[model samples]
Target: MTSSAGFTASLGRRRAYWQAGVCLAVLLGAVYLARSHWPALESGAGRLAVADQGWLLTGAVAAAGTWAASALAQQGAVVRRLPGARLTATQFAASAANHLLPAGLGAGAVNLRFLMRCGLPPGRAAGALAVKAASGAVVRLALLALLAPVCPGLLRLPRVSPLVVAAVLTAAGLAAVLLATPWWTRCRRALAAVLADIRALHARPARAAALWGGSVAFAALHALVLIAVTRAVGLPLAPLQVALLYLAASSAAALLPTPGGLGSLDAALAFALTAAGTPGAGAASAVLGYRLLTVWLPLLPGLLVLAVLVRRKAL
Candidate 1:
């Protein structure tokens, strides 16, 4: 029994190390991807200048709140207490890093390092991130389902040919077989640690609340940011419709693997806006305004905060 337990713990460590390595690899790719795609999106963001100042400010506030929500979610993921101010600052920096790198490259590395600095075992730290990510995905999907009914036909599933579906299934099956055969034992060992961590987390009511609440707030707040921007630019869509559209666009953008979901998200959002009865020009401006509030505005300050945290070795 002792030997089995020891092996599980070691496998957990391996999984954490593996996760960290993947983050670093993606960070490098994010750098490459961000540079290539930056110029394409840069031009349209300036159009947000004409949006209503009041609505823009509201979106700006919502954008900032995303980081706080992230911090809260992070705090709730682990049993230990994290220093609130420092954690929020780290999230700010992480956001900048996420923007610069894309996906979660910058942000994941930042958070993972901070958790380690706070004395979490590498495995547990990595598990915490996994739990947070899983919760966020769940909340996003939940919101999407709930909002879909309110806005009829706002989000439509594209028709996929049977051949394409078959190909995807085949690919997935092959990959699963390739990994499952050799790594099944090790994978189970690692998953044991993850499941144990999750069980422990759920045992505490407060942490569970924070975990789910922060996740819900994070998604809702982002949608609110987009809604405010859309309204500011005089998009014809209702606020609820805008929220639904943003959720759908963002959910779809997850498939593209773009750093920070940049080109894909921008394109998807504008397309969604146009599809949902927004004029073409209005859609473009709305997308621009949303990006301005969420990305361009806070970028510098976030980077500076990131620098401060690194200098202080807080991340």
Candidate 2:
């Protein structure tokens, strides 16, 4: 009895530490945004104030739909049906958690825990995440291919400088060194498990359709959010053109490891908007509007949901 009590206490302490870390990250992220990007944020909010309310409402609806799309994709990753309401709620919470840490770590940990709690083995839960990620990437790529033709010369490949080449080479060498170790063996096994799950999911036609369809809809809805924001702010770009720019900008931003692609995405998106004939200030305002709907506005409620889920042992 004493041992059990001690174990429970230890677990409680770990949870406390994790919660503290999340709080710290949120505080730091807020500070950074205020300190570094206050001007843009303020300007954008002011513009959004006068912007079209109807279009802003459209953007909000699209943003909300993304959670449902994510829930669908997540369910498609596993054979077992996750409770629909909980899954959607988890996606909202995960988005909130996603902004607290860099490179998707916060969201990944949250989803992994939720999956395990839903009765998946650790390996299977991890594989399900992998499947979801892979499908999202593939869907993004396919959409990019289909949309690229609409705006020719809009996305020219940047000249690869020697520095970029050198970085790639260095990364490859490091990856090679890592691959020589026991870690590589574990990674290989993990890859195999993920592949098996992928095969299992694809074997079921409904699951396969959900996986791909949800992924496509998720990306499209996100682009729609940005496009709607641009319209709200009266950016000159047409909706299709804006959508293409968003896909390109987001794809490039994905290469950078930021919390919710905060800095990287903001920069890339602003640049893309400006290059597409928007004034610099207008681009900044549009990006700010997009962030408002997707991140800042939803953040508090998401964190509250996360806390409630933790209390309920949902994650």
Write out the backbone clash pairs for model 1: 102-259, 102-260, 103-259, 103-260
Q: Show how many residue pairs clash in every candidate, following the order shown.
A: 4, 0
lDDT of 2 by residue, 1-315 (tens): 999889879978996677556545655665685567677667777887899999999999999999999999999999998988999999999999999776687889999999999999998998999999999988888888988898787776769999999999999999999999986997899898899989999999999988888998999999999999989988888788888889888888776556788877887887788787887668878988999999999999999999999999998
Number of clashing pairs, model 1? 4
Task: Supply candidate 2's per-residue lDDT for 282.
Answer: 80
Looking at candidate 1, what is the lDDT of residue 78? 95
Model 1 misplaced stretches (Cα beyond 4 Å): 1-47
Q: Against the true structure, what is each candidate's TM-score?
A: 0.84, 0.86
Q: Compare the candidates by lDDT and give the number of the best one.
A: 2
For candidate 1, which ten residues in a row score worst on lDDT? Answer: 38-47
